[model samples]
Target: MDDPIYDIELEDCPICRGAGLIQDEQGWSVSVACMDCGAETAHAEYRTPEERLEAARRVALLWNMGKVVHTGMSD
Candidate 1:
């Protein structure tokens, strides 16, 4: 099977840089372990409205491609 194409705009993972996981800091009173690299941060932000719309279009294209693959295999 082919891998799913990630054609949409995606923010880079700050901790792992697309490695998908990261280590957490210690010594805090209520500290939590970082299991994933894509945790939301105060400095992190999203794209603008127009950029988001373009990303939506790309996502739709990929979703339709997935549906085609599903139906083709089931038939």
Candidate 2:
């Protein structure tokens, strides 16, 4: 099976310059997180798959804008 794609674009982590990942919580909500720094954007809730994709995009936008919350783990 192929990996599901969200078609979202994200920027590198502002804290650690690492990759960003789009994450979903049991199909309920979506957010973007840094792979190395653990910085994350605010969660966006969704219902359908379309909404989930949109939510993923929303978080990606936040991540690109450097609007994520640093978890302090990078420090």
Candidate 3:
């Protein structure tokens, strides 16, 4: 079996606490905006791997739905 994704160490974002997305004067952006926060920096206290996977699955489902409705099926 593959290792757990969340098993990796998680560094807390001093600015957003690892929200993975932050809002500023320029609007929303990835966590990369924060100089103090680096990519792959997970939250010390955040969702588990299972939770993240579930969320991702839901998003993918929505994306597929939109694609089917607007673009139709691709070959």
Q: Name the top TM-score candidate.
A: 2
Candidate 2 per-residue C-alpha lDDT over 1-75 given as tens digits, one digit per residue, 9 for 90 to 100? 343434556678977889988887887998988878788999999998777777787888888999989885545
lDDT string for model 1 (1-75, tens) is 331223333433433333211112231111111134333221111255454444344433433332111111121
Q: Per-candidate RMSD vs. true structure?
A: 17.5, 1.8, 15.1
Strongest candidate by lDDT? 2
TM per model? 0.28, 0.86, 0.29
- Residue pair clashes in candidate 2: none
Q: So what's the TM-score on candidate 3?
A: 0.29
lDDT of 2: 0.81
Error of 1 at 40 (Å): 20
The 10 consecutive residues of candidate 1 with the worst lDDT sum are 25-34
lDDT of each prediction vs. the true structure? Answer: 0.29, 0.81, 0.30
Model 3 poorest 10 in a row by lDDT: 23-32
Ranking by TM-score: 2, 3, 1
- Model 3 lDDT tens row, 1-75: 453332333334433343222212222111112233332221222255565444434433332232112121223
